[model samples]
Target: MPGKKRILVLGSGMVAPPCIEYLTRNPQNEVTVDVASAADLDTHVAAHDLVISLVPYTHHVAVIKKPDGMRWLGLFSTEPASIKNGNIFDTLCHQLAKLLSFKPGERDLVMLQHKFIVEWRDGKKDTITSTLESLGDPEKYSAMALSVGVTCGVATQLLLDGHPALRTPGILAPYKKEICDPIREAVACEGVKLVEKVMK
Candidate 1:
C-alpha cells in the first residue's frame, strides 16, 4: 500500500504524533502525508487509499464511513463500552472514576496498572463473550475489536512485521494471560499495527 498513492492522515495533535512518527520513518515509497480537520474530509476521501482518523471518540461518527475505495482507521481510547449497553457503560464509568480519584502523588505505576485492568475488563467482558458465542462478524464486530482488541503497540507490530492486514488495523488489547504482561511489551509488540496503519 505504498508508492505515491495519497495517504491523508486526518489530524495534527498529541494523539496523532506517535503514529505520525511511524509513518514518517517507515516511508511507504510514494505515500504522501497530509493533515487536516474532520470538516475537510469529504474533499480528500476519493483520492486516498486510506484515512487515519485520530479524532476524539465523540467526533468519530463524522468519519466512520468514507467512499467505497478508501480504507478508514479510527484511533481512540478503548473504553466506555462503545456498544449500546447500559450495564457495560456503568461499569466502565465506575472504574474510570476510581482511576480519576487517585491522588496526584498516589498516581504511581500501580494506579496505571489499575486503570489498564479497568479498561481491559470493560472491553474483554464483551469481546470474549462475543467471540465465544459465534456472534463475531468481521464488519459488525470490527468496531468492538478496534475499541477493545487493538492497542497502539499491537498496531505497530502488525505493520513493522508486514502483517498489517491480519487484523482490522486497530489497537491491540492490553496485556493479559502473561504473554503481553508488561505495558511496554504490549505497546511494542501488538499496538504498532494501529500505528503503522495510521501513520503509513
Candidate 2:
C-alpha cells in the first residue's frame, strides 16, 4: 500500500480517544493525535495535512478560524427533515458495522443506534428519517464539526475514503446533534436485533 497520509486529529474527551483508535488501526494513514487548547489551535492547524474536528458545532468558528490544507469530516448529518427517521435506523446499522470492526465487544451500542427517529414537524406535514450514513462528504478546506453523540464510524470511513476529487485537497466530517443522537440510540438497539437475527 502507499504510505499513509500524515493526519492530525484535534480534540479531547469522549470523541478523541476513539478517533485515535480508529485512525491508528489503519496502516494506510500516519496519524498524529493531539488535544488542542485555545492557544495552540492556530499553529497546530497549519501543521497538518488533514484535521478531523470532533469539537461541538457551537465551537466550530473557534476551531476553524481559518481554512487550511487538511481534509475535515464533520460529524453532522445533512439529510432533509422529511426523510430522517427511516434512514436513522440504517445509519445506526452502518455505524454498528464500523464499531463491530473496531470494538466487537461493544455490541450493546448498536441497539442505541436504532429505536429513535428524527421527527420534523412543520405546519404542513411531519416526517422521520435515520442518520446512520446520512452524512454527506466533507467540504474542501472547511472546518467539519460534529455534535455530541456522533459515533458512526461508517460515516467517518466515508469521509476518510473520500472520492478521487478529494485527493487534490483534504476532507472533513463535522458531526452535529441532529446526526449523532439518533445514531447513538439506534446503534444500541440495532446491535441487539442483529445478534439475534444474523449472528445467531
Candidate 3:
C-alpha cells in the first residue's frame, strides 16, 4: 500500500499482541514482530520507521546502543528475555506466569505511582503524586497486559503522528507532561484510570 507506515515490534510476550493489534487497526500501519537479537537487530531496525522495544528493561540499553547509525523512534516496555530457547530467563518467566495466573472470572489489577518533590529557595516544599490504576476483564485482558500494551500502542501512535515532544531525535521517555498526558488520556480512553494529587 502507498504511504504505509512500517513498524518493527520487538518481543512477543503477553503484552505484545494487544500492542500489535492496536497499531494494525490503522490500515496504513504495517507492523512486523521479531524476537530481537544481536544478529537481526540492525537489519530489522533499519527496515522499519518505528521500533517498539517491549523486551526486558535490562536489555534496553544494549538494544538502543546497537543500531549506531540507524535512526528510528522507540517506545520501551519492561518484560523478560526475547530469546525463544529454554534459558533461565524463559524458564523463570514461565514458572512465574503459571504461579500468578488468574482463575476464571478473576480480574487482575495494576497500579503505578510516581512521586515528585519540589522545593523553593525559601524552604517550602511541595509533593506531587500521580497514580494509574487499571483493572482487566477476566474474559478479555489482564491488567498488566492492558496497561502496558495500550500505553505502548498509544505512544507508538503518537510518535507516528508526529507529536511534538516525541519527534525529537534521540531516546524519549514519557516523563514530561507534554509527552505523558496524551498517552495517559489515550490509555484512559481505552478504560485505564489515572489520578494526580499535590500536597504541600
- Model 1 TM: 0.35
**Candidate 3 structure, TM-score to reference:** 0.67
TM-score of each: 0.35, 0.36, 0.67
What is the clash count of model 1?
26
Local distance difference test values of all predictions, in order? 0.39, 0.42, 0.76
- The residue-by-residue lDDT of candidate 3 on 1-200, one tens digit each, is 24889999888776887788889998889999998577989999999988887864232222345443222211232544344365755554544454446788998778889998988899989899989888878787778777789889988888888888787888887789998888888888888876889975
| Candidate 2 per-residue C-alpha lDDT over 37-140 given as tens digits, one digit per residue, 9 for 90 to 100 | 66988887777666776652223222333344111222243643333337754444344333333242221122123333334466443333332322212331
Residue pairs of candidate 3 with colliding backbone atoms: none
Error of 2 at 96 (Å): 29
What's model 2's lDDT at 50?
Answer: 66
Return the lDDT, model 1, position 56.
30
For residues 1-200, write the lDDT of model 1, one tens digit per residue: 43543456565433454455444544552234456655766878767765665643322223335544122121234434344336654444444444333344332120111111123545642111111111223333223233333343235434444552444445555344332433334543423222111111
Provide the clashing-pair count of each candidate structure.
26, 61, 0
